[model samples]
Target: MNIAIGCDDAAVELKNTLAKHLESLGYEYTDYSQPAEDESNLYADVAARVAYSVAEHKHERGIIICGTGIGVSIMANKVPGIRAALCHDVFSAIRARKSNGAQIITMGARVIGSELAKTILENWLQADQIDPSSLPKVQRINEIEDSILSKSE
Candidate 1:
């Protein structure tokens, strides 16, 4: 599966480590992250790119990193059809995919170390998606999204 990855300056090192790990696992990924020295690439900018990739079906999943993960998660979820989850632990990461069918996982560089982040990433990657019985609930989420977007126009 093709994965999209991006991060801000604060998370550059962790992002790099994750990218290498993905490579070792034989996963194809697009890197939307900017260098640490590049001040122009903001978290929202990078988050939008990763979120859009999955939303457009160009990628199956994505990983985004920032100072606290919250900013990127909030920005990614703003896009229609994108379920971005901010996970700092293994359980949350598992639920992000297994329960919510999130296509993107966001992590915090300052809040979690590289090893824990790696573990979380691995667990999330291995988790199965939402169960078949949960399809109706997932559909309801989509319906709510459509209803909100429709009334806006």
Candidate 2:
């Protein structure tokens, strides 16, 4: 499957590493954001581009990165039908796909080590998406999220 990747300055290094991992996994990707992060980099643009690209790509998956992964996740979620999850471990990453149908995964450069991030990505891609009814964790989280979403609208 084709994947879209985006990252700000703080995550450029990690993003590059992920690119290699994606290549090794035989997944094609398009980089919407550049490699440089000096002082002028803003994650909003990168997040929006990645989100929009995923929307446009039709059935493709994506990954986004930022300093804490929160910024990119927040930005990506603002777009319709974009379920972006900020994950630091295998369980969250795997469950993100399994329960939420998350199209994009965001990782924090400062929050997780490369090794852990790699493992999370690997499992997330392969794990069976759990049924919403069978998993209370998934059901409750989505319910809470939906409540918040309803209030926001």
Candidate 3:
């Protein structure tokens, strides 16, 4: 599946590591990461780009990173029809896709080591299908998002 990947300056190294891992796994991915020297690109902006790409179906999934992961996850989830999960472990990564049907996963560079990040990414990538029981929960999430968005409009 095609993937969208991005990161802020604080997580450039981790992003690079993940990019290489994606390559090794034979998955195609587009990089939206800002250059380390360019501090002008905000994490929220990066997260939005990846989230929109996935929401629009231009990519099957996305991976976004920041120093703490929280910022990007929050920003990505703000977009309509996007579920971005901040995952630091394999179980969370798997559940993010299988349970929540998350199209995007966010990671923290400072919080986890590179090897662990790769392992988490691998599990998330392999979690292609959502669990049957999670269909209702996932639908409810979509319903809630639609309701909130419609009310705002």
Candidate 4:
């Protein structure tokens, strides 16, 4: 699978770890942000670029990383058709893809270790929500989406 990976300075090391994981999993990826050296990294910029890339790529998945993960996730989710999920565990990662049909997974450098993150990514990349059991999961996620829209209106 072709993937896009982006991260800020705080997440550079974590991103590299994930890159290796992606390679091991027999996937190809393109990095879109963050210099090798520490810099004033902006989560919004990375999120915007990654979201745009995912939207353009259609079937490709994206992995975005930041310090707390929340900011980048929020930013990416702001884009129409982009379901960016900030997942810290395997279950949530699977849900992000299987339940919500998320095309992007966000992670926190300080929140999860490399090994655990790799496991979560593996589950995410392989998960499919087309099973009968996933209907309830999709329903629950749609309920949350409905609540968000209702509150916004």
Candidate 5:
């Protein structure tokens, strides 16, 4: 599956590590990360880019990173139809996809090491299909999103 990956300056190293891991796993991915020197490269912007890419079906999934992962997760979820989950463990990563049908996963560079991040990504990748029983829950989530969006419009 093609993956969209991005990070802010604070998580550049972790992003690089994950990029290499994706390569080793034979998964095709595109990096949307901005140069560290770019003063306008905000975490929220990068997160939105990745989130929109996945939401538009430009990529199958996405991985976004920041110092604490919280900023990116919040920003990504702001986009309609995007379910971005901040996951620091393998179980959360798996459940993000299997239970929530999340198309994007956020990680914290300062919170987890490269090895653990790789392990989490591996498990998340393996969980390509959501649990069948979670369909109703996922549908409800979509309905809620649509409701909120329609109200705002």
Candidate 6:
């Protein structure tokens, strides 16, 4: 699967590690992340780019990172069709994909170690989307998003 990844300065190192792991797994990925010294690269900017790419189906999935992961997740979820989930553990990562059908997973570089992050990423990638038991709920989520978006427009 083609994946997209992005991060702020605080998570640049972790992003690099994840990129290398992706390569080892033979998965193609686009790195939307900027260098640590690039002052113009904000967490919200990176998250928005990656989230939009996935939302538009230009990429199959996205991984966004920041100091606390919360800011990026909040920003990414603002996109109309984007389902960005902040996940720090294996189970949450799996559920993010399987139950919520999230196209983007957000992580905190300062919150989790590199090894743990890799495991979580792998779990997310390996997860199956929209388990039968959760299909109605996932559809309901999309309906809710459409309802809210329609009001704004």
The lDDT for every candidate, in the order shown, is 0.92, 0.83, 0.94, 0.86, 0.94, 0.93
Per-residue lDDT of model 3, residues 116-151, tens digit only: 999999999999998999999999999988999999
Candidate 4: pairs in clash: none
**For residue 57, what is the lDDT in candidate 1?**
96
What TM-scores do the predictions have? Answer: 0.93, 0.80, 0.95, 0.81, 0.95, 0.94
Candidate 2 vs candidate 4, lDDT winner: 4
> In model 2, what are the clashing residue pairs, if there are any?
9-37, 98-129
Q: Judge candidate 3 against the unseen true structure and give its global Cα lDDT, from 0 to 1.
A: 0.94
lDDT of 6: 0.93
lDDT of 4 at 131: 56
Candidate 1, lDDT over the whole model: 0.92
In model 3, which runs have C-alpha deviations exceeding 4 angstroms? 35-40
Better of 1 and 6 by TM-score: 6
- Which ten residues in a row are the worst by lDDT in model 5? 32-41
Model 4 scores a TM of 0.81
For residues 1-153, write the lDDT of model 4, one tens digit per residue. Answer: 899999988899999999999998899998977643644458888888888889887438899999989999999988755789999999999887876788899999999999999999999999856457677876776688778878989
Q: After TM-score superposition, what is the CA distance of residue 37 in candidate 1 from its true location, in Å? A: 15
Error of 1 at 60 (Å): 0.3
Model 6 steric clash pairs: none
